[model samples]
Target: MDLLDFARGPAINVAMAVLVFGVLWRLFALLFLGKPVDRTIPRLGTPGPFWAGLREIGRRMLPHPTFATAERFAFFNGWVFHVGLAIVVFGFRPHILFIKNLTGLSWPALPSGVIYAVGAITALSLIAALVKRITSPVQRFISTFDDYFTWVVTIAPVLTGLAAVGHVGARYETLLAIHILSIAVLLIWLPFGKLFHAFLVFLSRGQTGAFLARRGV
Candidate 1:
């Protein structure tokens, strides 16, 4: 099959299956492996653990006062990349169509112009983040194969998407094929490494806070 046909058909299907099942399996394993019986009672007048956990999860989404100064760069760049990425992924017309096809859910998309602008900005942010990770002594020292691999996989879609949008460096069809292939790679990678944090963040935050709140902390 040609690259475009492969990217649009078998590659996408297999990648999506792997993404869905792999994520579900991992989540099930995490939930069931550490099965524990809770026998502790809450203090009188204490907030319920569930609500407290939800509160903590929401609260933690904002920068904490104690660590805000130290984490300023992370908070700023992280939000920029994440928000921009979200817009590009979920607000693009084609992506909305794909979602509608897959899940019978549809939402209005942002203008193509807006999507292009956000995508370009997100691509730059990702590149900047990669450079920082490579150059900073601390970040570089702590980097692993997964770190660099994740960076490449994450950035590929953005670059290819922009290329396809701008009709740069290749035919639009070829650029789109590359973009789709990159996304498939990203899907397959998501459940396996640091990218798992995308799924785990809410669960981790909630569980951590609930555990602490159960002890009246």
Candidate 2:
């Protein structure tokens, strides 16, 4: 098969399958891992554990005033990148069509121009975050190969997508193929790498808050 056909057809199909299977496997493993059940009685006068967990998830999504001055830039850029990336991924016409094909549901898509704008913003924010990771002493000290690998896999689709949209350095078809291939790589990488945090973040936050509430903290 040609590059475009392979990318959009067999390669993407395999990537999707791997993504689904890997994520399910990881989640089940987490479920079955033998952790002792919490036996502590929940504190009276506190929100119930479930509500506390949900509340904490929402609360931690925004920057707290205590750390706002120090982490405001990181928080802002991270939010922009995530929100913009979501829009670019899910709000494009082709992507909406793809989802419809998979799930037999369709949603209205934003204009192509709006998608391109969100893609641009996501790309810029991702680049800035990468730069900060490399340049900041503390961040660099904590960086590892996996961190950089995750960043590359995370950003490749955005870069190639923007390139495809702009018709840069190649035919639009070629760039689109590259973009699809990059996304395939991302799908495969996600369940096995730090990107899994996107799925696990809520679980982790909920567990923490639940535990704290049970202990009357």
| Clash counts for all predictions | 0, 0
Q: What lDDT tens digits, residue by residue, belong to model 1 across residues 69-118?
A: 97787778898999999999999999888778889998889999999999
The C-alpha stretches of model 1 lying farther than 4 A from their native spots are: 38-45
RMSD of 2: 1.3
Local error of candidate 2 at 58, Å? Answer: 1.3
- Predicted structure with the largest lDDT when compared to the true one: 2
Worst 10 residues of 1 by lDDT: 40-49
The residue pairs that clash in candidate 1, if any, are none
Residue pairs in clash, model 2: none
Over 1-217, each residue of candidate 2 has an lDDT whose tens digit, in order, gives 8899999899999999999999999999998897797776778888887988998899899988999998988999999999998998889999889889899888889999999988988988999999999889999999999899999998899999989989999999999999999999999999999999988999999878877877777
Runs in model 2 lying further than 4 Å from the true structure: none
* Residue 189 local lDDT, model 1: 97
Residue 87 in candidate 2, Cα distance off native in Å: 0.6
